[model samples]
Target chain A: MEKKIAHFTIDNKECTATTGVSIINAARENGIFIPTLCHYEGVKPAGSCRVCTVKVNKRHLTACTTPVAEGMEIEVDTAELNDLRSSVIELLFTEGNHYCPACEKSGNCELQALAYRFGIMAPRFPYQFNERDVDASHPKIYHDHNRCILCKRCIRIIKDEKDLPAGSQGRSIFAFNQRAKKVKIKLDDRLGKELSDELAQKAMDICPVGSILVKETGFKTPIGQRKFDKEAISLDNSINLKAMKEAHHE
Target chain B: MSKPVIATTSLAGCFGCHMSFLDIDERILDLIELVEFNKSPIDDIKSFTKDCDIGLIEGGCCNTENIHILKEFRKKCKILVSFGECAIMGGLPAMRNDIPVKECLAEAYLSGPSTVNEEGILPNDEELPIILDKVYPCHEIVKMDYHLPGCPPRADLIWEVLHALILDVDIDLPYELIKYD
Candidate 1:
């Protein structure tokens, strides 16, 4: 079946994408950048982080979840939107015990990158410093709850593909445990046993924060050379994995 | 016109930020030429001799003494800059913020593996500063004019801010210089 095309304007720039494509994808197709924290490729958009929020017809909408409509007028990169994004980043920083200095994911973490991009000298909100648990049960990785932003990318991404998967979806390796305020990502006790080194790296890579970390890989890259350390996270290209690998190898 | 006077103090910090400040290298000569040091650890001044044009505060408030000195700096300095991650958001010391202060004191003095308190005393003395319930960033205790965020706030960034503030110019921080780690 032929797919319909949707044309839209993002920040007054003409953008076109296939129908059902999210605003973020359409913007990306047009080389227009919409910053996101929780949004990841090949996974369903959760729209939990709210970092990708954009003004769609003067109303706030998550760019990753909202499909681009014909003649849709979307506002991105305005002062209001930038301020809103900055506030979200700040809120995350304050809400979590993100000790960037000691964190293994310091230079590579997307949350820290966003904070840097926004020029967040200090968070306006008071630090919560809530007590969080760390899960070292997994052999390949450890989960530091203090640094988590509750993005749920891991919960949505990591799956038991080792089994004969019926379709695109597989048994979830990570899931949300507990309820509001106490909500956190939990690694599947049984399925997590099959977690390969490659999957472990992927989990750490996709986390956007230092919450999920591969064992024995702490501080692999030195300061001033890690991902997002030399280059600011631009709108078009975010979290360059190849460049990060090159840095790690070097 | 008289040179702007500067005062600096470390509250709950590791003095790493101050070390980074000195990491300005030969710029120390330039900094001295640009400003005068007043009540600062570098000068060994115990009390403020006069009102300071700028005050650099390192670390957060973890004790009663930190609060007292921070308030004193707020009173004495015209423009106060919270220096480094500790002063900005409690940093590593804040890792214990979730645990009870009693637990912390116990671990430090009474119950920890390395601790050797013969009498099992918690060091409750009037001479010792009273510990607060939790670590607090400098801004929470007092108004701050600016904040430099980093483990040690990259010496170049500190230099830039100093230059801008001293010269009364806007800070044009390069993308690379503004890092949180």
Candidate 2:
């Protein structure tokens, strides 16, 4: 007898599949769309920005983080769902200093495209304007506190993929003061210091908003030419897994 | 069997709600058949009886006019639903309560950007009602039968609730839709 599988809906289209598959991946496979913010396939689902909120049965859920169940009815479009998503996107604009006029990642930015797509005419809510200060720590990485949505994509890339101390120093998980306790102690031995500028750049590339920008890449790629960046960013799934394993072993 | 008589009104709101209701698209006919919307401004119905099955009061009661209208609905409707987040949680209008009433008045009248309140604009004299310290939900002012929580309650959810009400079935929240952890 065959094992029973779960059913997940993608943009109102339904499909039956096995477990251990994310809705984002399943939807893509079935030619359905579930737009994501902090999720890159084969990398990790950060569930930040809350953009891909699809209705499961009667709920507005983040399609990336939410696991597929045996039977789920989903609705991906409607005024209410759009309203909630649009409001979330609007909140992202209002929460920080996302001034696209001066942004480094302006054209290559997902936030701007989504805003255009959603017809965000103006900022409805008065800007909270958190007045966040910059973090000038890394030699190459310039932390513009203003653009940081605090999505922690850099943190994930740093910790999981690159295995670096700077990535492990997230405020929510580990505060600024506690940086030296775990990963920071290895700093003295230069052997574990494999955090390359390219790795950092990839993390920056994965960032949906202009929160993370490669200091050099800005204005080089141009706007419309950098289309592939917006094209479904799934990290490890389509990459050379063998090379990744060999790199880890050495 | 008489259909549900629904009366809808807006107070201190942008009326984006009524606009959103029209956005339901093709469902408006179904909604109309489900409920007898006799007093909606959209219908241009000037007069309606208080003996309504469902009374959906949008916006929050700030002035005497709102209070009077709320009381009238309470006197008339059987089920009073605090429609939008303003009616439910006092919304952005309610958020103004965070400031001192004196400061709010000062900003509106003198220090504000527009800052000019003509005779009709300014509520002058002792007769002018004092601002409440904080915005209270409709539940605080009057008994609410059911609440549909949203900035503006989703048209689909509203439709579902109305359908359930008409069928005498319960409007239950599905667990899959909420954030537990």
Candidate 3:
């Protein structure tokens, strides 16, 4: 028999079976949720958003990228983790143009929803509310680079999952003006509306923020009509990773 | 000087978002000491009146009633907030926009005779509405002042929106959103 792994209880739910998955994935598999500001199901793990930060044996680690272990004690929503999450959220508010009300991806925005999840009812930091360009170069998709959180999930998903050309991966403002060698190798699928439908699905689903929203379909549905509201599903976890990936791709 | 009168409402959604509000739980009581849910399905009251300092509207507008409700709130609420993804975009319902609206309806109400049977047709209740050929973000219909974007608006966002509204403080997003996807 294999070596037995330790167990953990989140609000009393036994989460020991997910010993091999990440903390966030484990939590998600077991119906536990950790707020994430910059994470997606279809993409590779990027621990950019500190919102999923959890106290694993009193040490802070991002649930999105951190794996689970046997007999490891973890606290997801403690005062320290909550404060750290809040600080991370406050920073995002200041960095980007997250004008929730006027923006298109308001109701179903991952960033906006996480704010509500972590109880960031108020933004303590100043809004770096600068005007960022909306790269609507592609007819089917519109990406507001200003709102990007630099999770690189898009780049990873395209390169790692879909096996697309490197250029199709997006450019991050943080890494936007990086070395020239990097700029030499980028994917640019400048196709027409023939691929609009497919592009729209991928872009919208990949964006954790309201950045790459689908055009023309804004506001047709109201906020109350979305999913994952009552229960928090930590995308960083692997327990439900299979289901989430299937649901995400579908 | 006046206190912010807050109200929340939902439309063509699973009500999971409205349920997300409950994630705050006891904190909501603390929130309510100042703000009020003028016309929330879960909160007290019916038929949203208007003129709220902050209005957190969840879900997207899928039917005539949804359109009416969105317009009414847009007019009445001083600060109209698109509370959830449905409010922001059409969320999953909008996914059907990829298909024909009629086909979507047929697939649900008619495709399967066993589920759609009885008197050849069970009268359609106005509330159990049909979906559109496409899904959209809320800004297409009305002007939104603040947005809490999420499939289910985050508990952090709920707390932060409330705090920003009440304390009148500014907020900057965390480094994570910028650094990651």
Q: After superposition, how far is residue A200 of candidate 2 from its true place, in Å?
A: 2.4
Instruction: List candidate 1 segments past 4 Å from native.
Output: A240-250
Q: Model 3, range A62-169, lDDT digits (tens) per residue?
A: 887877887677787677678888788768865665555456665456675666556554455543434456667665567676567766654554322244566676
Residues A98-196 of candidate 1: C-alpha lDDT, one tens digit per residue: 899888998888998888888888988988888898989888999999988888888887788765746657878989899899999888888888788
Q: Rank the candidates by TM-score, best first.
A: 1, 3, 2
lDDT tens per residue, model 2, A1-250? 5656787665556787666566655555565655556665545677877888888889877877877776777677678877787788778876665655456676556665555455454444555544554554545455566666655555554442334566464222111223321211111123123446765576566666665555655677664355333332223322223224545786
- Superposed by TM-score, candidate 3 places the C-alpha of residue A164 at a distance from the truth, in angstroms, of 8.5
Share of native interface contacts recovered by each model: 0.92, 0.00, 0.00
Which rank order by lDDT, best down to worst?
1, 3, 2
Candidate 2: residue A209 lDDT (0-100): 65
Residue B145, candidate 3: alpha-carbon lDDT: 81
User: CA shift at B4, candidate 1, in angstroms?
Assistant: 0.4
The best candidate by TM-score is: 1
Off by over 4 Å in 3: A1-4, A9-14, A159-196, A226-250, B1-181
Docking class of 2: incorrect
Residue A7 of model 3, lDDT score: 80
Candidate 2, residue B19: Cα displacement in angstroms equals 36
